[model samples]
Target: MAEDAIVVDESLGSETLLDLRSLSVTYQTDQGPVPAVRGVDLTVRRGEVVGVAGESGCGKSTLASTVLRLQPATATVTGEVLVSGADVITMRWGELRALRWAGASIVFQGALHALNPVQSVGAQIGEPIRIHEPGIEDSEVTARISELLQQVGLSPSRAAMYPHQLSGGQRQRVMIAMALACRPALIVADEPTTALDVMVQAQVLGVLEKLVKDLDVGMMIISHDLSVLASSCDRIVVMYAGRVVEEGPAHAVFDRALHPYTAALSAAFPRVGDPAARFAPAGLAGDPPDPTSRPPGCSFAPRCPLAIEACREAEPELREIEPGRWAACIRVGEP
Candidate 1:
């Protein structure tokens, strides 16, 4: 069944589990400060999965990594990253180490590389407990590790096996179990199901969805796959050239997208009921502008189908088109 996404109307509660305000990230290259993400805002409520979809190099991964402060020193980041009311950027090394896993956890894109290949899966999952819950006994830790493995649909006994001993899907399951080990209030999964077989991806997504429900944890599921986000998230934010182009409830965004970029992205994806029908993705023509050399006015103006001279000279704010739906394009109400 396709889950209808929730639209945020003016009356909708502003209470957020994770809040990102006017966030921007700039990389210091030989060319100078290169902005990867600009003036982006996102809010994920408790127990909801918010999907961030964008093309490669469109800052989806950078945005997710910023929430964890995982980027390198060269990246100049300015913004308020509030998780449960504490600003993540201001936290010191000790505070950050303590806050992570306890406050939020991450399931990185490459589970195989994320896991310690030589270590038993059990140890990797238990590492969080050992660090954060040092007060607990070894017997208690063992019991918790077994329960976590079971929670992610892996056999409890499999924990004793090494990463190489499990299939790709099983490794991903271990990663999810590790993220949930400390019962984190929030989780950031960066293309978590990537490189898995279809059946395995479905299984892993199912486990993640179930965990979000059972644990009441907020989540940010970042990917380029439209259907995956549509099926898994409560809301969707579409990005292009490091800026938000469109955003709304997942169902509404798919059913009646308001932005040209949104329409183009949907056309690129194979429809669920008509998978056999080939979809010739309308690839966005021309390469993305160099980050250090982004054009004035609308960043996507050059690629927009309905762009005009005004679009090239005027920056468009992401505004509500209809209730919860928002688009950064100047032209609206078109097919």
Candidate 2:
């Protein structure tokens, strides 16, 4: 049977910005080869927001790293990472360097650490512009810096401030501006809202949301928080133990998840002002199986409350249970 395609509207933007085909990554550790991602296929159009949700160790970050060839030397990657129909894995050093900011960019998870403490935010944002467009005039670079800062909701004056001088949210916005500085077709944001207050998180998200709508830039946001993804993304892909477990429209995945792992994740977040959520929120027990020694059957079976004897026999392939909705579970649609 054909694989289920992610529901996309051609009118939104038919141009494919990022496409991953059967992509897998395994890290060569001192102990053994640890599989971080397994046979994951994803696509991001020119003007869309796709959210990747999963707990730590589920390969969410690894997937994001692979997009820009940012994975470490110890990691072995297989399959294609197509950025605008160009394969990143096979590109030469010169071509890869050129592709980093012009073809795609990344908003790293840690804003303070990612930015250089010594340089001003404006200089940092201008670095990519200068490197990618050496012929650009000084006046144009300054103007572009101010424009990007404004686009991310920061005052142009804030450009003079150092990383430590800005608040957490402001630093994140600066990172976003840096990502947009090159005007790349695709942006991969790995946990863009980490360690901020709920209100600040909303503001950061608002900046990203507005950028997507106004600039028509394709974005793939990776986070462990399902609620954040549910509120911001058009579509959500839920990962578990290095493989995608469920994927569908954001609202449907949050409200009516098909896989047990997705359901557990949805239940883990407490709803604001809801008494039941505050006091009786669901808790998922057990850690993900060790990647180097994963079981033969389902990686989630031992932790799943609905696991059956048959679940221990073989891993389930991701299949479409309904139009445009897919899940990897033998017991999907069962009452």
Candidate 3:
């Protein structure tokens, strides 16, 4: 198993499980091409949990979907997306389909909608196993499904129930079980705990954390909730206006944010026991920029409290502000 390092060097043998180099996704719209993700360079090593956190429409989901080539036919994807050293973008259709579960799988949000309403949870969990490993025996598939359900903190019997019959948390657990059926090296969990109550969210996250660790699988968890990421992820990458603004160790990004956007995001989620944070939670003043009509220069400059004349002239590149930490603000190293 790989060591529990938040940042792993790309030079470190084959530890890099997922590598995105200058990855971008643009959707064809009636008006024009809308860029949902732009020049995103990220890597996830084995046995690491990386979190992507941002506000709605910030392209968190787009980045996640693009990794698996799950985007729509109208969307245009460019650049390299390497999963287990295989380029997903150029892979043939047959290879891509075969890679879906065995290479990487997604636990999408809204499990109620993601799962078939009429199918039993056990069947849903076993579907991927049967599809990817067609020669597996029926009895073995049934046993694997039951074992997965139990691993996710659900009773094996619960697998017989339909999606509608399960609670929100139970449905999310089923989604996790389905993702694990293939034992893929990487898992992208997009808002895995969405719509669940606070207690249930914690429970689901705990199960996810345990599974990722015990299986030594790389994981990329996308959520609008910084607190959720901070609690469960080893590192956090902050995205805004379809670009990464900052990334660092989760505790550092949550407690000592460098970029204005990341700082605002961290403050938006107040600490439970902190009296000051509860009373005066910080908030960003404006909505994200339109994808098709992104303004010149920094996309976030219009709403950035510390924006200066230089910020309006060009978009800042993501530069290392500290060792193993990156931020896209020109003022990051300023006094």
Whole-model lDDT, model 2: 0.91
Report the CA-based lDDT of candidate 1 relative to the real structure. 0.85
Q: Which residue pairs collide in model 1, if any?
A: none
Q: Write model 3 residue lDDT over 55-92, tens digit each, in one string.
A: 99999999999878989998899999999999999999
Q: What do the candidate models score in CA lDDT, each in turn?
A: 0.85, 0.91, 0.91
Residue 268 displacement in candidate 2 (angstroms): 0.5
lDDT of 1 at 322: 91
Judge candidate 3 against the unseen true structure and give its global Cα lDDT, from 0 to 1. 0.91
Residue pairs with colliding backbones in model 2 are none
Span of ten consecutive residues with least summed lDDT in model 1: 1-10
* Candidate 3, residue 296: how far the Cα is off, in Å: 0.9
For candidate 1, report its TM-score: 0.93
Error of 1 at 309 (Å): 1.8
Across residues 1-335, which tens digit of lDDT does each residue of candidate 2 receive? 01111334543437889999999999999998999999999988877789999999999999999888999999999999999999998888899999998889999987999999999999999999999998999999999999999999899999899999999999999999999999998999999997788899999999998888788888999999999998888889999989999998888898889999999999999877789888988989999999989988889999999999999999999999998799999999777
